[model samples]
Structures are given as structure tokens and as C-alpha cells.
Target: MKNKLTRIICTTLAFGFLALPSAQAAESEFSLDRLVITALRAEMKDLDTPASVTVRTGEELKATGALTVADALQFIEGINMYSQGPYGQSAGRMSSEIVIRGAKKGTLVMVNGAPVNMNGLFQLDNILLENVEKVEVIRGAGSVMYGSEAFGGVINIITKKQVDNSISSSIGSFGRHSHSLNLQAGKLAFSGSLVEGGETGNVTSTSTKYTNYTGSEKISLNGAYRFTDKLVMNYTHSKDDINKEDISLSTNNRQQYSNDQESVDRFSFQYQDDTLLANVYGAFREIDYYTRNNDGSVPLPTMGGYPRKADVHTNLKTAKYGLDTNKQWEVRNNKYLAGITLETEKYEQNKVIMTKASAPASPVITNQQTGPFERNVIALYTQATHQIDDERKIILGVRGQKTEAEQGKEYTQLLPQLQYNEKIGESSSWFVNIGKAFRLPTLTEMYVTSDRFTGNPNLKPQSGWSYETGWKKQIATGAVKATYFVLDMNDYIETDSTAAKMYQNFDQYRNQGLEVSWEDKLSDKFSYTVGGVVSNPQAYYNRNWSRLYSRVQGTLGLHYTLDKVSANLSANYITDRANDAPPAFPVSLTVNYKAQPETTVFATVRNVLNRHDVTTESTPSSMSGYFYGAPRTIEIGVKHSF
Candidate 1:
């Protein structure tokens, strides 16, 4: 593993056209003066925030023909966008999930400065780029500023506020078509998109087989109005319908898998000025699903009786509302920021089953039930920065929170963070940061006790300490960022596999890693970026820490433009994986040309290398119980602005 990491790093530096670790869009530069808000609730320069950050612009994403955010985020070094095929091809896990430092549920997701993660997970494949303005990612613990579910990091998706009118359409492989529209009138701005498509031949593996067709329909709607220069309101909605029919070779059965419908709605009102920023918002999410075999087949009778057909349905719904506010003050070159947050979430689940076995026995007519749960949280947080000299500064921050759950005992905590940064010169600086992080269990993880799977309401919250140190330098046309981080976690949550076992608090685990990246322009029409990460993120399994992540993961990208034509090539290589790991290497290419002053044409080819990377896995073994990657496919589109 060490030799492979060294060789890759050396080769990347020698090539100069590196896929730098910073996933910034080519149009963006990590300059010291760039403004960011995810690291701290208040606006601050990248150099002043003292953390590893990356930003991707929506314009560049659309121009590059990225189908969704998941397509672009896969190239970032520290994140693993484990997905069951882009769009709606495979239903492996639940949705497109982002895992940082081996923690899947520890990443906090937000939009426009408000928490948007619903029911412990958020869907990324449905968020088209047309409605986004930019994405900001802070790659370390943020629990001191944000209360819970930030044990790994924070990702904030900023939607477009300024209106730009345009209409676009596209058609791709596997009988796919999509359209988008954006318009502005008076004080209102709107953007919406619709997409549908899939292929039967693209997703398959040597052991598992996806013989039939899989497809999906996706929609997004967003609108905003400005009441005044300092006040604004916005509403965003998304819906997705997915279905797939496949042949399960392991079971030797023909079955169908799907999440019939998934949707989200968000409404927010905000007031912002030079000294204060506040938001009041409400959000809701629903996921409905039913799974059964293609034919009406019943389970084999266990008690010497005939079996009968069955119908089963399951659904999950959650409603969340919150208020977040921040006030800033500057005194004698020092800065202070204070804020308060109040939030409540209600989670409900419904299940219905109908079946009858044994012809002479009494048949159950109907079965209906629900799981109801609620949690309320209040938090106060503040940050203070003191300048000891022109080149040195110190930051101290803390958060206090009280949480109450309907099915569990009340909990309270106080978390703190500290950082110190010093400048070496005008273009370089180094910093050290230490903080505490925590993650609260989801409603399903705590209160949903059942026959097949049991949940324990008394499970404790996972808590940890984070230590990070990094250096940043603005070198010539681009920049360089290097960071080393350690995460010490205690009382990790684990679910025992014993029959009808419950969720429980287990032992300890740690994640430690090193990251180095660079992005720059080589000439007037060409550019390259390179970055890599080496880490051994461990998970507490059985009696000890096991399951290390991919030891060496590197990103690759190159962009070229001349006149009205532009092209981009991107890929990722990962090796030294877990348990008989299958090979993983996929590449993508995109080309664009300006046809007219207001019209543009583009083409995108996914899986350019046609690599048979593993997309979905059922076990640790590589020989079976898995699905393959997206076959070589091409898409064409055109956009016109009015």
C-alpha cells in the first residue's frame, strides 16, 4: 500500500496535469480572498476559516454536462459517493449516499444555510445542476458550530438566486430524455427540470444478473421572491419515481425492486443585513415502496400448510422545521459571532400487510400499523476571534444544546473548538484546529421495535474529538493545500445481527489520513489539477477495529478550450480496498461547442473506459452478490438563452 501510494503521487506530480484534491470547478480558484459560509455560520475568507474547503459552480457543472451532483462529486479524494448506478439504474442501498472518513450518517447535508437532510439520508441523484448556484464542502468535523449529525463534515448546496432565463433539452442512451426551464418576472425567479431514462444492458456482473429493465422519472422545482433588498423567500421541491425488474442469480428467482415514489418540499424565509443573518424554514420528505416477485408466488409453508399470496407496503415520512440566526460584531480588529437555533422533527412510518395461509384456517383480513416518533432540539453557539499580531490570530468557539425525544431520555451537551493560524508571508499560512463532534441516532435507529429488526430507545449518542492541522499556499497561477486529520470516536453505534437484536452502543474507532492537492493553469487554453489521499479509516467490528477504506485513492482531470469549443476528461482510480475487492477505474468525457450567440451544443460520454467497476455489493467477497458499472453511453443536448 505504501509503495502504491508513493508511485501514484510521484506520477501525478510528474504529469503536471493532475486531478487535484480540491474539487473546485475549473472556473473557481482557491484564492485567499474567496468568501465562504459553510466552515463558519458567518461569512469569512477561505484563508481566515482555517479548514479544508472546496466549491463547485453550477455554471461549470452544466457546461461540463454533468447529469447530477453525484457525477461530479465522485472525483473528490476524501468522499465516497457509493451509489447503485447513476440516475435510477440499480436499487442497491437506499439512495446515493456520501461517506466521509468511513462515516455514512455522520455527514450533515444542508441547502442555502439550512439543514435539509431528512430521515437520516438525502438523495443527491435527483438534484439537477440547472437549479443549483454552487456547492460548498468543508472536509472536517463541524459539530461545534452545528449541533449534531456533523461528525464527519458539512456540505451546503446553495441554490441560484439571481435569475438567468434559458431553455434546454437533451437525449441520451437507454431511451432517455430531459428538459429544463428558467424564467424571471418582476420580483420572482423560477427554475424547473424533468428527466426520465434507463437501460437494461448497462448494469450486470459475473455473479449477479440484472436481466430486465430499470428506469426512473425525476422532477425539480425551485422559486424565489425578493420582498426587499434585505429580505427574501424561497420554495424548492423535488420528486422521483423509480422501478426495476431483475433476475437474482444467487436466489435463482425473478423479482422486482423499487422505491415507488420519493419526494421533498422546502419553504424558507430569511432576513439578512450587514450585521445579522437569520432563516425560518419548514421541510418535509416521504418515501414509499413495495417489493414482490414478478409472479404471485407465496413463501413456502413451514407448518405443513399451503401458502397464499401476500401484499405488503411500507412508507416513511418526516416533517422538520427550524429557525437559525446569527449576529456579528467587529471591535478593535477582533470579530465576534453569536447564534441560536431551534428545531423540531417528527418521523412517522406506515406498514400494511395482507395474507392468508392454510385453506381451512381463518385468514387475516387486513393489517395496518405505524411508527410515530418526534425530537426537539435547542442550541446556542458563539465564536470569538482575537488578533495578537498582524500575522497571527486565535479563534475560540462553543455550542450548547438540549435535546428531547418522545421515546428516549433527554440529553444535553456542551462542545467547544479552538484554532490558531499564523502567516509565513503574503501567500502562505499554517493552522491547527481541535474540536468535538457528535451524532444523534435517527428515529428508525432508536424507536422502531419490530419482529425482524429491533431498535433500542436507550441507545447513546456517538461522540468524538477531532484534531486537524493544515497548510495553504497560493503558488503562482494556482494553489496548494495539505492537511492531516485524526478522528477519535467513542461509543460507536452498531446493530447486532442476532435474531431480533437491537441497536447498541459498542467500542471505539479512529480515522486518520493525509491529503495533498494542487490546481493550476498550464497555459492559456489548457489546465490540469491533481490530488490524492492516503488513509486508514477503521470500523469497530466483532471485537476490534477492522474494515479499512481504500488505502490509495487519486483523482484525474484535464480541461482544454479553444475558440468556441471546450472539452474535459475526468476519472478516478482506487486500489487496496476491503476484502477481495474488485478493480475500480472509471472515466468520463464531455465536449461543448457554441453554435450561435445564444445557443450551445454539447455531448457527454460516461464510462469512457468501459471499466467493469463494482456498483452494488451484497458481501465482502468479490466473486459474487454484486452488480457492475455503467456501460459506455453517450448523451447530446442543446441550450438556448433568451
Candidate 2:
């Protein structure tokens, strides 16, 4: 089977390139002028960063019918998704526990230059993707600029700034449909979208076979005014709401409803001159979520019966302010860039859960409020980039952070980073980076106490030291890049499941991995990319090492265009994995297609051979199993712009 799969993949790549000539010519057209300045506080080319990164453009997203950020990122290397089921009951509950270079969740996610840390849980759903202009993902620790919860890496969503007026809509199987509109005039831009979908098992063999519905609405507006050629001011606002119905087969055939709403407002000022550039930004955000579960056997209080119900609510509010400045100077034949940044963030979370009884006779009640928690963090950082001669460059960076909790614990950290880039040839470069990063426990991780889990007030911070090296080559045909990285983590925070719920403590672990990718245009009409990643992740406790570590992932893509029609096909695979513990079945072969630049259709036969794949097992004995990848379903949708 392995040999056959390999042969098929190779055949597809060869055929895809043989059909494209224009694509081959466009591959060699490289100019630095197309690059845009990013607020990531770093000066980097698309190919220069010493980490694994992937960028998805707005056009590519529309072509693939990607309704969410996670959907669009599904094809990227080293990324995966988990869900309990399909539709509303399990809708927003899907876990995007992004694992980059073997680092799991706890990664930092940002939107429009602001941190969207909803209690250290990255749940910015794909509904937000409708208003996104681009996405930049960096794999590995990035605490120098982002601070806490960056131990895994960073995902930045850049919202759209409309250049013109446009509207798009689509409808498809399983009661799926959507519509969107964008408008821009002068210095102002506004956009809005609505999506509604439902599923009933009758349509396909893979359908979840339950009544499920999901609806979402979102809006964003931004404006910029130039005070002078070197100065500008900008303001932006965004809001989103999502509602879903839950359908689960395991527990008494109960139905549930979940709703999530978020709003963000931000303002920024920028100034630039021949040798200096500075930016200041301030932002505020609020997020709220509510869920209600109802089992069939439970009767309403007015009906004189017991009510088997659960209600959970959470609210989060955050304020952030920051400033950054950069200066450039030249001496002899060398040039240098020095920059410094200061930022602070205050975050709070309030949660409540309740259970009730049907009136008449039975009387029942449950604790409603889980203790509220708040945390504040402040950080200052600096970085310097020096060009030594023309073939070699060096970067030195460091950050100092102070964190305060409402419970009276104060924590501080000093992290440093060093990197070097050497031009091996006119078209090739080699780069290496060594850095230290840390992550503080989340508010819930520190104070929340519930029937499902327990919080640990004494839990120490988790720290990681990582070393990375890579090579990038841009040839006449296309581009090739490869990287090798290893991380040694101390005081790793993991849950202990021996108790009824779970506890937290310091656990040691190590992650080592390699990634390689190649993209080439065989001809003007054909282009292809092949990439793969392999890693060994393990845990250590009480002076003993556990062997759970080994994962292999890979991808191959092909594209062809003829006049007004364009076609794309790609397949991704992940081998069975283990962490010196039990082995999980492999997940392989997800294929997607886009016909005509505006229409996308996909079919993913997860666990192709119908294998039971266990992707994640939480420390508390709560396990998430993917028993047969989504049952082989077909998704078709069309989009139009005017």
C-alpha cells in the first residue's frame, strides 16, 4: 500500500508540471519590491526567517472555499485539527491544538496586530477568515515579541482593507450556504458577512446523521488618515457572533446550543523618516460564550419532572497598549537596524455553571460561579540587525517581562536570542537561531476548580531552550527550504490524572524535528510543491525518560491554469505517532480541488482505510479519538466577486 501511494503521488506531481508553461516562467520572477512591512517587529524577507513559515493570500483562500482560518491552514505542513463530531453541538468545541515542531496548544494567536489571548486558549474560529486579507504563521517559540503563551509559536491574522466594492455568495450540500460584501472609499473600508449551514445524515454516507445547524455573522471597519508624508493615524473595529446546535450520539441523544461573541477596537499612529520609524497602538477586546445542554429524559420545572441540564458561561475582557521604534544607520559598507518595544496587557476571565430542577416537587441546584481570575503582564524588548559585509548578517535580541496575578504571585523572566544568516551563493542562504522562551500558567490553569478539573496555584512556569538551523535556495526553477530544530523544556506543565479530575506540576520533555519543502514550476502552466516533516517528542519525569516520540508528515500539491480556468489538487499525509506510550493509527491522504479561480470543492476520506486513529489523550484520562476520518464526505461550493 505504501509503495502504491508513493507511485500515485509521484505520478500526480509529474503530470501537474507537464501541463503548465506560464507557471514555470512566473516562478523565476523575483523582486524584493513586492514585500510589505509587517508589525512583527522584525525585518525579514519571505524567505529569510530562520523558522518554518507559511503565508496564504486572500485569492488562494477564496479559491479553496475556506470558511475559517483552520480550514485554510489544513494543507500547511505540521498542522492538524480535532473535533468531537460535526455541526452545532460540537461546533465551536473543535480543538485546534496546533502542534508546531512538536509544541502543542498554548501557542499565541493574534489579529490585526493585537493579542487575542482568551485565557491562553486559541479559539479564533474560521468565521473570522471571511474578513481576513492574509495569514502569517511562524512555527516554534516566539516569546521575544509576543511574550507568554508563545511557547509553541504565533499565528497572525491580517484583516482585509478593501480596495474596491465586491460581494460574494455560495450554497452547497448538507444545508450549507454563505454571503459576504466589502466596500472601500477614500481612507475608509467596511466589510460584512453571514454564513448559515446545517446537516442531516440523509445526504451522504459520511454525514453525522443528526440535525445540526450553525450560523455566524461578522463585520469589520477601518480607516487611515495621513497627517503628513511621514506620519499617519489608523483606527479599526470588528465584531463577530457564532451560534450552533450540538448533536452527540454518546449521551442520551441530548441537544445543546452554544453561542460565542467577540468585539475588538484598536487605534494606532505611525511615523517614519529617512532613518527612523515608530509606531504606537492601543486596543481593547471582549469575548463572551454560553452553552446549554438538554437531554430528552429531562422535563421542564413546570412539567413536574427532573431537568437534566447544564449551563456554562464565560466572559473575557482585555486591554493592550504598546509602542515600537526602529532606526537605521550606515557605516562604511555595513548597515544596521536597531529597535526597541514596550507593551502591557491586562486580562480577566469570569465563568459560571448551573444546573436546575423541574418545579412541582423535585428541588435541585448547582454551584454557578467559578472564581474569577485576572492577570497583568508588562514587557520590554530590543533587537539589533547588523549586515556584516554583504554575505553575512547577524541578529541579537532580548526581552524582559514581569507578570502579576491577582492571587499575589509575581513572576519575571529574561530571554535572549541570537541568529546568523550566511549567503552561501547568489541564490542560496544558510541560517541558524538559538533562543530561550517561557510561558506562564493561564488564569484557569491556576485558579479554576471544577468537577472536570482542578487548578494548581503553585504550578511553576514552563521554559524552553531551542536551537535551529536551516538552508534556503532559490533556483531558476523554484525554491527549496529545509530546517532542523530541537527544544529542551524544563518545568513543563502537564496534568496528572491519577485523581478524579486532574492536577498540574512541572514535567520535563524534549522535542526535536526536521522540515523540508520544495516548490518548482515545471512549465508555464504547471507548478508543484512537495514537503515533509519528521519529529521525535518525548516526556521525562522523576529522572526517567519515556519514549513517546515519532511523527512523520508530508504534503504534495499541483496547480495548472488555462485562460480563465484554473485547477489545483493537493494531498496531505500524517504517519502514526507515539510518545513512548501507546501508538496512534496513521492519518493519511486528504485531497482538495479548486476549479475555475472562484469555485472550490474538496473530498477528505480521513483514515482512508477506515482506521481508528487516536490523535490526543489529555493527562486527566480524557481522551479524544478520531474513529474514521469524517467518513469520506464531499464538499462543494462556488464564490463570485463583483
Candidate 3:
């Protein structure tokens, strides 16, 4: 009761921010129509980019009261937050996955222009939304500039480059608590955050009965230094630990437990001048996993029967070093970019599994493996942009990539891109783009081994190509766009369920989609946005529809500001999406209110329609059986910036 009152008081205090005096530079108003897009690897206006792009500013995200980067992206068109957790809990035993335009395994997620999404880990929980400056989502092929894991699209998270000194604390339902601090001094800046939270299961349902307790903790630190006019450096470190306990099968007492922990460290140095740009970076990532399953059928020591306990432990480490350089030149009506990148990565893995034995305390190690491998890659790329006339422009780009592995065959690929943009009117444009991309198999997917799955050393790289055409119109108060895209892929990798869950290349995969969106200011105090994507994805060999690919997905958002108070409401809906047994129609809602200039309160109610449909893949033989869809949940929180 006391805690509830305290929360009310905090919320009340936050709402009081509106009562304070308003200060601004001439009370000038900013419009979303003025956003300029730079995530296409070039400086261009949103309507002139020749691709489908969505930009979410930090201010807009903050208004939604999302705690993590992934949460803030839920409303983006074509993005499927595959698993938002049961209830409002964001952390599960495994990382949350997202599917874009019917492409589940081909998305690339980056932070400050660095790749952080690794094999099988797609969540962005490590990066807090509080530190994010903006998010850019490119909904098409990006391999020409971003290399592997980019066949679907690219999600670029930009962190705050300038942070004012401040400290803040927040508490929410589901026992969520967090504290953060940011400090800046001249050329040096530092920021850090710690979050602790979890969920308690619902008691009324069969699925939620024993599948309740989930807990997680995350810590992150970032620092930057500007040593000189031409030299700058930045470093970031983060750690996450998650725990889950649930019942796999409802008929038995088989309780499942899992613990996953990860740590990442990265450092980058950059040099830039008029026509010369260079960067050197190093990164290290490590993960530890432990899982235990006990059916409780094993008799106690006094009963003289073996305990039915099964456990597995795995440790994986990866390190990467890379150097990149780019030179820009201009000649009359033509501009060119020439770049080269060389990178080397090392990977090591250790795994052990224990099964039931005569001794209850100590089980026999039934499976064990140790693997260490390395990969080297070099890429050369060049791009040219020519202005033919005031109404027409064209871009041509090409990249050659080569990869060599320590214990596998070498691979090479030549990717190319062509784009054209034409001005339709003073405030509208039409564009088209075609590109090729490829992704090499990761070390874990190529060398790791376990009871349920095995890696094939001879796995081949996956290659694909995509084409898109779009039109955009900017009105007096907002913008609208429509796009049509198609993807053709070959040598796509997948698990051959007929062969002990080994990985194999699927012959061909195809996807075609249409995306449309509109955002406008209805009035001086109100704004609205509506967008959606519809796609058809299929595998040629089997002639089957892709799993979990939604045929129709959409989002709606509304914002209103009156006097000192502001309110925001947004919802996302997905239809004809498959995960476990049946197709699900999932919808989520978020509402936020600002009480003060630096304080706000928000509530998120996911699965508002009470659709308990599963949102993840499930397997019976391993710890994956615990994967389930999020349930209807409501979370409320308050934040006060100081």
C-alpha cells in the first residue's frame, strides 16, 4: 500500500512539470515534415532517398514511455516484435527476435554504425532508449553498404552524442526499477544506466500457471573523447543477465530453468577531413548459458533411485578488429565515394551437458565440445551520384567482398546497386532502386554442436537480390509514401529437420510486398500517423508459406499537446501471423503523458485484446519449449529528469 502511494506521488510530481514556465527559442514549433534522412549512407531528404525509410526521433520515443530500444520500435510499419514477453516483461530466456517484410533472419541491427546483432541474438535490451538520439529503419536490401545480415533491412540506433549532466530514477509495475546518470565536460562525455526488473506469472490460465517467474538485470556504460580536430574516440560496455523458470509441459511436473548472461566491449577511433575519412574499431563479446530440466520423477537419495536431472552449459567468445577508409570527391555534376574495409574475427566455444546417472549429486557428462575458429574479410566499394538535371538524379554503387575461414572454403561475392530519383513536383518525388546482398555463415552456425542440433562445416553463404519502387509526397503539414518491393534469394540456409536438425541451404525463397504510410498534423495541437505492410513470402522447393511472416501489419499513432500537458497514444496490429499452432492477431497499445518539461508518466498494455497466442518458435527436446507469446499486460511508470 505504501509503495502504491509513493508511485502516485511520483507520478503527480512528474505531471507538475507543466505548471512551470515554458522557455523556448521564440516558441518556435518544429514539424516532423522537416526530418532529413541520413541512414541511407548518404545525406538526402526523406522524399529524395529512393528507398522506404522511417525515422523516429528520441523525443517521439520518449513520449511513448518505452524503456528499451526495441520497445520504442514496436509501432514501425512491417516490423514484428516477434516476442514482447508474457505480460509487459521485456526479458525472456533468449533474446527477442523481429521479422521485417517477411524476412526473419536477414535483418541487421546496428548501434552508432557498429554491428551488434550476432547469430541467434536479436534483442536490443542492452541499449536503453534514454540514451538513444534517434532510430532509422530502412525497409529494403542494404547489403551494398552494410554487408551481411542485411537482406531484409537495417535498424540503426544512434545514441546521444551530447548529453547534459543529469540523473534520473524510474519505477514501474512488474517490479521494474532503473537508475541512470549522464555527465559531460568539454570534450569528454560519460553515461551509464542500470535496470532491474522481471515478471510474475498469471495464476488463472493453464499456460501461465507454472510459467510465471522471469527476472533480468542489465548495466551499460558509454564514454567519448574528442582528442583533436581530426581525431575522436568512443567506447561502450554492457552486460546482461537473465533468468527464467517455467513448466514446459502442462501434464507433468517437468520444471524448466535457464540462465543466460552476456557481456560486450567495444572501442572505436575515427579520423576525418575534407575528403578523407577513416575508422579503426575493435569489439569483444562473450556469452554464458546454463539450463536445467528436472521432471521431479527421480527418487531422492533415501529412496535409492537416480534423480531425473538434465543440464547443459555453454560458453562462447568472439573478438573482431576492423579498419575502414572512405574518400569523397566531386567533379562538376558528379559526386563519388570510394571506400575499403578489412576485418578479422575470432570465435571460440565450449559446451558441456550432464544427464541423469546413478549418483544424484553428480551426473555424467554425456556431451562436450570445444571449438576455436577465425574468419577474415576484405571489401572494396565505390559509389557515384550524378545530377543529370534539376529534376533527375542517379546513383551507381558496387562492392566486392571476399571471406576466408580457418577451416572452411573461401567465398567471394560482387554486389551492385542502381538507383534513380525524379522530382515529380515541388514537394513530391518518385524513385526506384535495385541491389544485391549476401551473408556468410557465422562461426556458431558452422561449428557448434549439441544434442538437438549440429553444425555443418561446409555450409555455404546465402545470396539474394532485391528491387523497389516508391513515391513520396510532402504536403503543407506532413508527408505520405507508398512503395512496392520484391526479393529473390538463393542458397538460403535453414535447418533440415529430417537430418538431426542440421543446417542446409534451401534452393530458393521469394517475397514481394507493398508498403504505404501517412503522417500529418491534424491541428496545431494534434498529429496522427497510419502505416502498414502486406507481403507474400514463399519457398520454391517446398512451395510453402514462410512461418511467422505476417501478411498484413499496421500501426496507428496520435499525439496531442495542450498547454503544459502532452499526451501520446499508439497501437500496432499484426494479422495472419504464424508462430506455434495457430495464426495470431496481436495488438499492443502505449499511452504517455507529460506533467512537466522533464518529467513524464506512461503506461503500456501489450496484447490489449487478450490474445494469448504464442509469438516464438518452440521445440520439444531442448530449452526452447518455454517460448510462448506475450499475454495481456499493463505496465505503468514515472520518470523525472534532473
Candidate 4:
């Protein structure tokens, strides 16, 4: 499919902005008093932005009993997590996955407005809820403000700088345990956590073959310093290590291997002031894969079939460095924004192998290496807002991206966005957003060829447009919002159906959906949040359509507070997905008691019903059970503030 329809929608939206006079801004999806930063790329109340955005405060985060940002994302309406077993570390290449509307390459995750979706993986694993200030979610295209990867949505986790001093500890099922500390002294503050867990089960096996996950270790640290009232500096670092055992039944004598250690390390420095926000970050992720038995031999991935020929050890690593800055100014009823982004990424791989023969295998090793392949990106963007009248407003945004890479030709594209917000009354409002979205192929998809994947340097990028319209109303005791969105994409990227499955581009894909959410206070000390999504996501191939995943997903949360105790219960529901899979329902509860003015005790329960079924597949439509949800786990911890 071509992108001709996008031009039509863009023209229509531009006409609506001029013809529709009495439009500006009005209600909030959460509360009228709430402020959203990501929706507009600046500090503005939710009532003033023409986007579907959700803001979760620090207090509300604690109520959900979530230790990490990924845990809480699982319950959000249009978001999904395909974790192999738990949140931090899992068993496979695509483990601990996060996607919006089942598009893994579309959503972008950030910390304080800095992109951290390195190597096509979400970067939220290092952020602890305790050190967060707020989380902002913007659905639909955000390429105008961010970059190409923000095609589906954007998740921004804002951390607290000067936090209260505290120390905590907890222990739970499957040798799960953690320790954390947060402290602030004058203008300096620091927070960090160490988590460890062990699990041995059928987390990734599909044919009754034996599989085991030995253990995983994770560490996260954050620090900040305020040099002046309007200037601050921040630093973040995280490390992860995972160990597992693998066995392939199709191989001779059921060949075996051990994941000696699969690890990732990330660090970043951020600088912020009244007029500017910037970050410099780096990441390193590697996997030490080795085969066991049979003269250290393993099956080699081939076009015809898997052949047991190479005795190989694999090492894969990705290194990234990025810097993005934003500058803004105000002139009467208009606000202008100018920004620039620069990033460089490299993919490195090393394979140590020796071919095996019938009699004996060579004792010498043959080493194969791919370049520390580099890709550089340069982008410039701007946004301008004008108040048409007392109750009407319009926004214009655009971005230009230039790419120079190792294999593909030099590529460049421009993305533009238009928005209009209208105020209906003192308590209700409506808005419309029409924009362009895109996604470039990652290095792994174009440069790295391994045992299971074939690279395609000829792959083209994916391009599309997003159309969204929403309305918000504030009731006496609660707020309600409804959003309708559609996505039309061309040259949709996927794996080809050949003996050697190389990455390829498809004809077209379309996704449209409706989302509804309501938050209310039932009583003086009781409240609830409800959200649901109805969507039909399908791909067009060979002039036919096919479903992506479940068509319906919903969430429910109940909160109660009285005296010194508070409790929260949350639930997620999904209809039957593709490939004869079963429906999914996962629920959790958190209870906290303020033992003293500076101390508190809390307990959390996950997977209350313990339904250990297929959580997600390798692909959106695959039936080869690749992952499952986390089992029931209990944790009790105490926190003391000094």
C-alpha cells in the first residue's frame, strides 16, 4: 500500500483547524489539576493538550504495589508485556518484551525525555517505582516531537531528584529477594536497588523437552545534584545477568548447552535547566552462548535445515551513545520549541567455532567476526502553538531525520503533525491529532546473521500515518475519556516465508481501535480506575487479512485508604488471542500499613489465581508457546525513613 491516504487526512486536519473556530482546550483524562509533559513536549495541564495521555503519580504508583515500571505497564489499556517468566531477566533473546498494540518496534521508552530503547528493547527495567516522580504515556504517533521509533506510543518515566531518605528489604518465592536504599543530603541525592531471583521450570519449552532457568541478578543506581534553583544534573546506571540451560531434542543425542552468562549494562548522564534538557548515554549487552557434549558441537542454522556441524561459542554486543536537547521560548499567546538530536550505535558479534567430522573434530578453533558496525542519526524538530481564540488552539509540529549507516543507502525523511483542541464547556473538551509515523530497520535486522536469523540489508523502512480523535469529561466524582485511533502502514516489515527466513517488507497493515477509561471516587476513602480497549489489528498479504492478537483487553483497579492503612487491587483481562491460545487474566494486590511517622510495612501478591498458561508467543500469530506469565509470588518488606 502507498501513503496517498495520509496526504488526504493531513489536508482534512488542516482544514478542520481553520474552519473549526470555537476550539482551544478543556478537561483532563485523569484530573483537571494534573500536568502532562510528554503529550505536548512541555509543561502543560492535560486540559491544554490535544493528545490521548495518561499520567500516573508517584503515590498512585506505590498503591499498585509495583516494584518496576514494566510491572505497572502490563495493566495499562493499550500496552502489553511478553515476559518469559518475570519482569527483570528471562530466558530468550526476546525476553522481557514491551509492545503497544503488538508492534514491538513501534513504541519508544524514555527516562526524563531521553531515548533508551537500545537495540530494540525497552529500557524500563532499571527504573524502580520508589525513585520515580511520575510516568507519562502518550498514545499514537509522536515522531513530530521525538523520533521515528515513537510510531505507536511513548512512555516517559520522570524520576525524583531530592527524595526522602529510606532503606528497605524483602524476600519471596523462588529465592526472590531485594534490597534498596534512597537518601538525600542537602542538594545531593542517591537511590539504588539490588534484586536476585532463581527459577527452574518449563518457562520456554514447547515440545515437552526439559528447560530450566538457573538464576538472574540485577542492579540499578541513580543519583542527582541541584547546582542552582533551575539547573540540575543526573546520573543513572544498571546491570543485569541471567543464566539458563538449553536442550534441543531434534539434534543428535538431544544436544545441550548452557547460557554461561547473558548480561546488559546501561549508564547515562542528564542535564536540565529552565530552558534546556539534554542527556548522554551508553549501553552494552552481550550473551556468552556455548554448546555442551558431542565434542562441543552444536547445530548450525542453514537454509535447508538445521545441521549439526559447527562447535560454536557466540558473543553478541551492542554499544550506543546519544544526545538530544530541547530549547523553548514563549511569545504572548504562542510557544515555540526547537530541538536537535544526535546518536551513534554499533552492533558487534564474535563466533568461535570448529567443524566436527565422523571420526574426530579439530582441536583448533576458527573465529568469525563481524565489524563493530556503526549507524549515525541526525534530527532537527520544531513545534509551535497558537491560541486562535479564548477557547480554541492549534499546533504545528515537524521533524527531519537523516541517517548514514554501514550497509543501507543514506536515507532521509520528514514527519509533520497537526493538532486542534476545543473547549465545549467548563467540564468537557474534545481534540484531534493527525500525524506521520515511521520505523527504520535496526542493525540486528539488517546486519547480524546468526543461528536463527538471516539479515537483509535490502529491507526498506516502514511508513504510516496516524489519525486520532478524543473527548474528555469531568464528572462530579470522577473523569471519563474516549479515544478512537487508526493506523495505516506501508511496507510493513516481517520475516519472509522461505527456507532461509530473511527479513522482508510486506504489502500493508492496518490497525484501528477505541479506548475508554474512567476514574472515580466511590467514597471518602475509596476509589477505582477502569479502562478497556477494543481493537482489530490485521495485516494484508496476498490480498487477504489476518488477525494480530486478542481483540479485547481491559483493566480494573480498586483503592482503599483509612486511618493509617491502604490497600489496592488490580486486574488485567484479555480475550482469546491468535493460534488457538487461551484467554488470560492476571490479578495482584498490595497492602501497606504506616507503622510510624517515618516507617511503613507492605506486602504484595502477584498472580493470585496462578494460571500458568501461554502469556505470549514468539510472533503475534505464532502457536509455538515461547513465553508464559510469572507464577504466584508473595513479598513482605519494611521501609524506614530517616
Best by TM-score: 1
Q: What is the descending lDDT order?
A: 4, 1, 3, 2
| Candidate 4 residue-wise lDDT, 1-642, digit = tens | 224643553365345323433321211123544688887877887767798887887667666667888777777777766666565344435546676665547888887777767667755666788788888989888988888678889988888878889999998888888899999999988999999888745566567454566687878888878777666666776766666555555642344545544565655566666677776766666666665444234433431243433356777777777888889888999989999989888888888875544444434558999768889999999999999887789999999999888855677879999999988787778999999988888888887777666888887788889999999887888888899999888887766656566778888877888989998875556667899888877776434576666678899877766566666777888885665567787877777778998888889877766666566743433345555666677889999999
Worst 10 residues of 1 by lDDT: 301-310
**C-alpha lDDT of all candidate models, in order:** 0.73, 0.59, 0.70, 0.74
Kindly give the stretch of ten consecutive residues in candidate 3 with the minimal lDDT sum: 19-28
Candidate 2 — which residues are off by over 4 angstroms?
A: 1-42, 46-50, 81-95, 126-133, 200-252, 255-295, 300-367, 500-503, 541-550, 578-642
In candidate 1, what are the lDDT values of residues 254-329, reduced to their tens digit? 6554446778788889899999999999888887766544432644322225342324566778888999998999
What are the runs in model 4 whose C-alpha is more than 4 Å off? Answer: 1-32, 88-92, 208-210, 247-257, 260-269, 290-312, 354-364, 541-544, 618-623
Encode model 3's per-residue lDDT on 590-612: one tens digit a residue.
Answer: 55556777776666655555555
TM-score of each: 0.89, 0.78, 0.86, 0.88
For candidate 4, report its TM-score.
Answer: 0.88
Indicate the residue-level lDDT of 170 in model 2.
57
Residue-by-residue lDDT tens digits, candidate 2, 168-271: 66555555555666666665655555655454331111123233335555555555565677776766676656665556555535376667777767777778
- The residue-level lDDT of candidate 3 at 133 comes to 77
Clashes of each: 9, 24, 6, 6
Can you rank all candidates by TM-score, best first?
1, 4, 3, 2
How high is the lDDT of residue 516 in model 2?
90
